[model samples]
Target: MVKKVIRIILLNIFSLFPLDSRKIIFESNSEIKDNSKALFLKILDLGVNSKYKIIWPVENPKECKDAFKEYKNVSFVKKSKSGSSSLLFLYHCCTAKYCFYTHNPLGQRTREGQRKVFLTHGTPIKDTRGMFWPPYENTDIISTSEFAAYLRCKTFGGGDDVVRLLGFPRNDFLFKTDKGTEEYFDKIKKSKFIIWLPTFKRHNISVKRRDFDEDKNSDISILSPGFMEKLNNYLKAKDILLLIKYHPSQNLDYVSLKSYSNIITLTNDQLEKNNVDLYSLMGKSDALITDFSSVYIDYLLVNKPIGFELGDYKSYKNGRGFIVDNPLDFMPGEKIKSPGDLYTFIDNIFSGVDKYEEERIKLRNKMHKYVDGDSSERVLRYFELIN
Candidate 1:
């Protein structure tokens, strides 16, 4: 309470500035109003010093204004300026009082006088798979998780001196009032939901979003037809509701999976229609099934069972691989490569033959050490805009 009050006071003071020179900007080519990015913008808006100003760059004003009409302190920038003019325009824009980056290279390239903070928003950045890009210098890297920070350093080669362990404010949703941890448990107590979160396989061309044309050449992960069939059977036999959740950017068409009564294919349309809270969805599930996504870490909050779909383990590792201290021993939960194998594993657990929650709890404890609900508050404190 006291801390929040302090922040509010400081923000009021910052907002009182007469000039627009105290602006903080978030730059991205993607839709700034999208759910993934919007969540971050929303949090920052909460601590926005009304006077300091916040801006978003949009290639098209009509589109951005139409989408973000509800949000104040957001403006569009059209770089009608070309060639050296474009560079100059970008450089001039970066001269904000403070600029926050969700990823790398945008502001770091030429943010000469701006107070820049690199905020990593997603979990896929750790591996060299799918859309891996070379790492470069950053101002100060704000990490959502310690493991994420470790992976950043190990793969990107940085040390603690430059990295700040401030969790992603967007994740504050996981701990929000009325719809957070407690609310999640209340809803989950009623149903047996299973989340199947798989990374895009190398040849899964359909997984790429339609907007991202550059990813048309991507490959899908190794799939075992027999395994998929067997897993489908298990869902049918148990009368369990199976939810397949993939990356948001992945252009996955889950319409085919609807043929199965027990299987629920989550598509982008479904995501937008339901306005589902992922943390709540994961919380409601009995167990989680995933590949390399960091969703499992968040699911740990519910102390639910987590399993890996490693059917294409070797190939995935080869493409966008991991450096797990031990593939089998380092990670938490059981590893099942084949759907048939996963069926047997699920059967055993559902039969009340194995207590998987215990291990899930321990793993959750390890992964969650850095993720208290107060991470966003920590991040806000970093600006010293508020105490």
Candidate 2:
């Protein structure tokens, strides 16, 4: 009883501050740029006709601030030092009639507000838990997959009416020939491209740094010298160019590996270089290797081999979390559990039997049905648009 009271008091204390305060005070320093801003910019472009103003309140709003450059009405309001990020959302729920969001576990009051439509921001993994999309007593959930919707219902105890299985808006380019695929395919047809998109799991170093710091490295050993060595070796061994996509907050000194002609680092700004959308990178890659990133689920659309690095799966589940029906069911090519296992898996991808294409396509079809390049249109229409 005392603990519950303390929690309530803490919540009230947090609610008193500005949104930027909570985020700026807690977010890690390794942030390269706000990728979510880039994503929301895409959203603004698609929804330019809509009058419902889009508000993005992030700690580092510099990169995302420009996402609204094309649109006049889109607003970027940085929360004052006293406001909390979660509380800011809660406050906005009362005022903003409609809000589109990505990640916010504390988003409960949206049910009472006009509407809060969510875009699945990051790739989900197998073992993720209640944090991704919390099962609130009352709230509408916009999910990226039927699997995700089902998981929210089954795992977190959310009801059927609360879950909306809309496909991810970001992947619209993957299905659209003009938006991303034509350009992406043009690149892949020339050379082998391996996109190393690992999860933010401490084991994989994909989880937000703030969350990991709270635990103080008790479970996962994030980014050891040995791990860096393995990655360097991977860079050297193959002609395949690696597209290293880190989490928004992760800061891998990709410059250290840039000496190798086969390695390249992908930043949010770099998206403009080849007009590459992230999903297109996945679609055009020769093979997809990830720790727990759900991007594999999307990459499966290309019918390529999907590899899993579970070197610290046990530790990650204990520390961060996972998001799938069965953790192992989603891993396609090989379930690697150690440094040596990762090496072997890479060897097999380059030299072994390439037999994961069929399963990859089958799963991609089952998991993703609405990859018709109309996801953005559908999302905009759901909010009431002409096209």
Candidate 3:
């Protein structure tokens, strides 16, 4: 209660000062990543921030600053915690004329004259708590497709005023082909690249969500040592490199990840340290392997092979239900249930045989109204910020 009051007072106090029309603040869950970072970089790419002040309030100012130190217009401030916007953070948030954020880390709205746009982290597939209810209501939310926009309003529980169907800015990175991205691609040891992204499953353990399972769910550790080695041998022989990017919420220790011949694990810290743009890397990858992660939804733009390793499908559905009734209906890709299935998926990719190509295209058309990689432009044009 005290924290809430303090934040409210600070926001109102900060609102008294005139908002800076040329100032733009970007924020996320205090981590210098996600759609917020994507849009921030997009603004810089336009070569329009020469006179504009760009600020990002983060938990680690030094880390965030270093991530984009090449840009002169960028600055980082300590993020607000509990309710204290660290004074400096509050000042920037209140004064900025435009703000782009994924998570509402500020926790308070100082939108007296400021425009707030919420670039939600990702599309909601499971009944995740933070994805729905509150904060999202009445905020300008970015979505890729009309179906996604509808899903956002339904899951996020916001009115028509909340949605902007101009597509996600990060997906634009996937469409890019630059020398920088090419260099990153060249760093890979194998000729072929594939990425696997697993969704966070916090609620799968005797959790609480309406209609979700209360009992503990089955464990889904599909990466046994034997399985990893076997998969690694196949990847080595096939000249395919597999990159597994774990969710921040999911602990890597549990996986007992080992150094494999043709497999590598990527973490948020590793990506940040290298200043690598994730979606840019994804754009160049050959194929994708994911389980209930919204990253797969965005990968639809790549129009490549995708495989869903739903080892614990039943438990996951019963423990943490999907937003859509028939999740498989939306999944237009190979289904991997065992080692044999996974190997087959990889083999098909190597052979340039896509079984679900038609289904993927159909679903892609159904989900994405715009297939072109100009979503970032759409967003800027919608706001009249660009010609």
Candidate 4:
């Protein structure tokens, strides 16, 4: 109570100084990935950097600096729990004209003349339990469509006015062609590639993390003793490759994913270093494999085949819970519940059989209003930053 009052006093005092109209601040949970990096890249591409100054706050400066060494336009401030840097981050928040963030930047509400956009990490189907919402006043939350807007508001706890149907900037990569991105993944694009994304059971982070009673490890049933080896051989035979990018919060001990020629693993570090976004690869990939991840929601726009593995569906539903009683019924993809089902999904991809094309398109139409890839632009124009 005392700290909150003091922080509010500080913010009001800091607000005495005129906020810069062209100044924008971005903070992300993934340091420098998610919608923050996507919107940043789009801003650069649109030549908006020349007009507006961008400040990206991260938990680790040294590592992020080295990872994004190529860029010289934006400034990075060390965002942390406590220290001089934390105070500095708060200072930027009060003074900046615009704030874009994945996580809630608390301590103060949006000041007069200051705008905040919660470019949420994903379109969640999971029900709200431990979710934290940004201050409602002078804030806009990103969503996909009318249905998705309702879900965003429902899951995140905000009014309909607080949630906007403006698509995610990250999903913009799906609709457009980037020559640089294509050239960067030139080798990986040779064979049929399917990206498998599994949602983390437990989010291992201090800021805004929730713990579930999740002992569901697929390594036993899905990835048993010789699972990768067999899956690798099967993919190699079909001249297909599997690209796996696990959730940043999911704790794992990676040993030798490189041993399998048909399998490749991607990290935020690799993507950050290359200045590439995951959605860029998803746009060109043959298919997507996921389990209760909202990546498939955005991938719906690409109209590509998607496969869902529900081996731990019951366990997850009991733990995290979801918006609907039957999430599987709503899914527009191959229902892979076991190894045999997964193999069938792979075979479907190999033979160009999109079993859920009609369902996917229907759901895509229901989930997204704008499929033109202009979300970042819409956001910029919404704030009158760009004409």
Candidate 5:
């Protein structure tokens, strides 16, 4: 309680100084990258002739220094836990006229004159905690689709006016292409590529044991003994590359799988090092394999084949229940429970016998109202309205 009072007092003291109307702060997943980063880059590339400055707080400023060095309007500051640096970070947050973030801001509230936009990380599929609670008091605007906005308001108890029907700004890249993206695509397009993205299960003894057991035989783990051999042999024969991008929460040691030439583990550092965006990777891939991850929803915009490896569906549902009425009906891809089924489904997809194509399109249309790549423009226009 004393610390809270001190923070409030400090914020009040900070507010007495002039705020920079030309400054905009951004954060995504509390990291230097994600949906928020994607949108920020798009806005910068659009050459929106605005004089506003971008303040990005990152753990490792060096990681982003090279990428953003050319931008005269952007600044990268080192984020600290507690100290003078922390106070400087707080001052920047308090003084910025516009703040765009994926998650809730830390130790800060929306001032009366500032605009706080919530660019949510992804669409919610599970019954997340606080989904039914009131929206954060600091969030002045939320960027989401019409359908998602309706669901959020009804389920999460947020006001309708705050919801923006403009599609997610991060998805704007899916509809457009560039030289860099094309080069990245060319490098990976040599062989048929499939990306397997799975949601993170909590780290508990039960979940760890389940993961270990499943890793031995389930489709979730590409390193399973016999399953790995079959998968590698099939990939080698078909000239296919299997790219596994685990959730940030998962602690699986993907480096050990490097021995298999056909199987590659994609880490966040690898993506950053290659200057590849997640959405771009998804767009370039031939097929996607995931289990209860909202990534599939985003991949639907690409109109590609998708497969669900729901080996622990029962356990996952029991642990983190779905918000939808029937989770099975919500999926728009082929559901595979075991490695054998996954292999068969991959063969069918590669042979041009995708049975779920129509269902996938329908789901895409139902979920996304706008398929165009102008979501970032819409967000910028909103900023203009209030500015």
Candidate 6:
């Protein structure tokens, strides 16, 4: 309607500027971080020559200034503003030779010759409802595997040719380590670390329902006082540490779990301050525990033990229908419904008893075509081919 007409008008107007053949833009999670950031850093480190300039946009310039201050070819632009920043964003969108994004572009359509590459945040484990909608239709290239490409085309209405077999750039670090990431591992290497990541359930809950405790319905309740105390006692005895990475949409009161010596909650501010990303944490962890999150699929690359807590599977599946026929069939871990069951499974995993390792390896091979550390190189080569 009117917005579409306005967008077309703006795009056409912005096209009057001369295109910068050597300019490239990168974005992740609507911020300057994610898969796109990881890829950009790798490309920067390769010293791929000085012809190309990299433009990154962030909601707050000061927050990320330190992180990018050392790079000579990189420029940070504010994402929101009344005048200059907005105009700069528009100009970059309209004139940049290539744009790599984890999500869709913010505003303005891609000019005729410009390329838009979608480096998806994670592999598909749940139904992505709006992926087939208008915003994603203009993606010229999408990074995914043959198996995942088929599923994306079938579920998200994209063509097969747009799918590139290059593995996710963020996952590249999972196979190798460097001085930068070794510090993060050293902090937790003393104890066996297990990360519990659960999908968001706010959309399925009504705000007007006073009786519903959203935290209880999701897997966050595993950190309840009683259960955490019991889990902490067992973990301390076994020298195991449990880390909870909550979904961005879930707002849980972490005060209860803060007192436990063995339980730690990873906060967004902490992650930003330390310059650590989710995939890096996943790579360093000994095991993963999740329910309906695509993180487990990525963790499969590490070939570690995984546990599932599907206490609310029926409600979630009914409320948000799945793209797969039977979600349970795709899971490569034990399904534990209660806290006791979860603890018992973890105890077994710690005691050198893993029945699901074979199944996990099989699923990992099926989902990811390449496990080498050259996914970033593949993406850079693809850009070279098109350029």
Which tens-of-lDDT digit does each residue in 1-387 have in candidate 5? 876778678888787767788888887644666667766877678754247788887776676777778777887777742322456667777888888877656324647677777777677676665533256644544545676666556556666777777778778777766666577667765368888887765432224423222333233443466667778888888788788876766555432334367777776767766767777777778899988887787788888888888877876676657777788887878888877788887787668777888999888887787877778777778778323
Residue pairs in candidate 4 whose N, alpha carbon or C atoms collide under 3 angstroms: none
- Residue 236's lDDT within candidate 5 is 84
Predicted candidate 6 versus true structure: per-residue lDDT over 249-273, tens digit per residue: 4444422435367777765656666
Please give the lDDT score at residue 260 for candidate 4.
Answer: 67
- Model 2 lDDT per residue over 72-135, tens place: 5554444433334444444543355444555543332423434544444544554345444445
Error of 6 at 200 (Å): 2.3
lDDT for every model? Answer: 0.54, 0.53, 0.75, 0.75, 0.70, 0.70
- For candidate 4, lDDT tens digit of each residue in 1-387? 877777667778887778878888887752777787788877877878778878877888777677556665667778763423456667788888888887655224747777777888887788864467533643777788888888877775665787777789888888765665677678675468898887766555543444344564442247554878898889889999888877776655422334468888766666656656678878888899988888899999889999987877777787768986678767998888888898999999888887689999998899899887888888778777778
Top candidate on TM-score is 3
Q: What is the TM-score of each candidate against the true structure?
A: 0.71, 0.68, 0.90, 0.89, 0.87, 0.88
Stretches off by above 4 angstroms in model 2 are 1-47, 60-67, 80-93, 105-113, 122-134, 137-139, 176-190, 203-238, 251-259, 265-277, 317-326, 337-353
Native RMSD of candidate 4 (Å): 3.0
Q: Report the Cα lDDT for residue 89, model 2.
A: 40
Candidate 3 on 1-387: residue-level lDDT in tens? 988788678878987888788887888767667887677767888865776888888787897677678887888988643333578888887788778877673323636556778777777666664544474333577887778777666676555566778878788888886565577667874888898887754423323433324322322367787778888999999999998877776545555446687898877777655656788888888999998888888889889989998886777788757888899988989888988889999899889988898999988776777887788778777766677
What is residue 364's positional error in candidate 6, in angstroms?
Answer: 1.5
- How many pairs in model 4 have backbone atoms within 3 A of each other, for residues 3 or more apart or on separate chains, i.e. clashes? 0
